[model samples]
Target: MKTGNKIKLFLVDDDAVFLKALQIQFMENDDFEVETFSTGELCIQNLNKKPDIVVLDYHLDGIVKNAINGMQTLDKIKETNAGIPVIMLSSQDKIEVAVSCMHHKAFDYVVKSETAFVRLQKVISNIFKYQKMEKELNWYMDRM
Candidate 1:
């Protein structure tokens, strides 16, 4: 969780082109190791892979065949691992949607756009920084 360390990232999106593009963009950074999933189910199935973070889209096609949306997938993920950081990616700009995501314990939400990748990198970096600090703080407290 140190800065510049290789952080495993699992990215879930229904858009094939966007998934591939993001995989490439994230992999270009030495600090990131990216895996792309075209569906939330696929990502969930591979949750044992222990990715440091998950980037998930807010919408998906064919998920649950008829019932589930990305938010439901997010809920499932949190159910399985509440501490894992999740960053929601969506084109939706409504404040309610963002607030709902936060209420559900998402680490952050980003509107999908040309600059989304850049913003994602920054967010991940901050996550790592915070995690590192938390570890240090816990160690200090344990020694007290």
Candidate 2:
């Protein structure tokens, strides 16, 4: 558990306005330390900061020509640190899109909507809970 520390969050989206809005909302909460990136490449480059979680847009190629999409970025993130949980964000409400993200090892998928922030908050809570449980389980197993 992070305890007294704020969660390090990486927010990536090509939509400047939307990105700023999301960043603002998260920044309002004292529990998050957020960094914004306009492209998946930039996010990848800054992986050294070691964000606890990443909220990545599904379509990152909107602005940059030939920019890598979210899936590619997700793959790179997983390759770097499989344990870091990534939550995919997209305007696409299709089940297939969500399933595809899950198949690619996304921790969760959030569709952009009126209630997106609430859903993202719940998912983040679950991730911490799961991580704590896993850590405890590992500790017990080591004792055995």
Candidate 3:
């Protein structure tokens, strides 16, 4: 993954309006290529595209009564590709929920707010920055 390339991101949310807003926010930046999905199943199916990050809504109660939630989706994604970063989002700010998401290897748990998009952008940047640092360290170690 070259830093020169735009980061491909997958955002899964059942809320149509919120999903659209997230897509718009991420797409506005030239550094990101955003893909939106209404269900976690759909997003997981498309992981073959190898997105850099995933933004998943905690509750995926679409038309499907048995739809998988964000934590379940996070587990599925981690099982597929542990390297990909997944950030869980929800309106509920319960500590147990956040802790559960973290236990499932979620990169971050964000509660929905008016400034959620702004915070998301920062999280994305931090992930990329940390990845860059890790890659650089590995390169140096290989040379050693």
Candidate 4:
């Protein structure tokens, strides 16, 4: 990918070890510019940076169940920038949770596992393709 096409990715998870691992993985890959946060609040605070994609954990510390969770974070993110795509991360394998994330407009959801990195790569590629098409469409509309 060209330098101008490199995607900015933000990862938010409460697990410090997981965050560090993901940071290292992305750093080794040239396609992504990765930033990580240990809390959803920190990620929200950095919205001005306009990251192209956000990877969010399903459960967060200090957030009440059935009230505020990753789904709530997803909503807040969309409120801030509706066009920004988000990928929900969860250890849960329940289909309901995955469906809920999709219903709430998550770009994709992946279960935490050894293959998580592979899934993330696929999601990033799809998001990039969608974003590129969106940008082109908007440009064409502007020329009309």
**lDDT of the candidates, in the order given:** 0.86, 0.94, 0.91, 0.86
Instruction: Give the alpha carbon lDDT tens digit for every residue of 1-144 in model 2.
Output: 368789999999998988998899999989999999999999999999999999999999889999999999999999999988999999999999999999999999999997988888899999999999999999999999
**Who wins the TM-score comparison?**
2
TM-score of each: 0.90, 0.97, 0.93, 0.86
What is the per-residue lDDT of model 1 for residues 1-144, given as tens digits with 9 covering 90 to 100? 445567889999887888899999988877778888878888888999888899999887743466356788799999999978999999899999999999988999999999999899888888888888888999999999
The prediction achieving the highest lDDT against the true structure is 2
Query: 1-144 in candidate 3: lDDT tens per residue?
Result: 337899999999999999998899878888888899998899999999999999999999875789898788899999999999999999998999999999999989889999999889888888878888998999999999
- Candidate 1's displacement at residue 105, Å, is 0.7
Report the error of model 1 at residue 18, Å.
1.2
lDDT, candidate 4, 9-86, per-residue tens: 899888788878988998898878899976677788899999989999998764334435677789999999988899
Q: In model 1, which runs have C-alpha deviations exceeding 4 angstroms?
A: 1-5, 62-67
For model 2 the TM-score comes to 0.97
Better model by lDDT: candidate 1 vs candidate 3? 3
Candidate order (lDDT): 2, 3, 1, 4
Candidate with the larger TM-score of 1 and 3 = 3
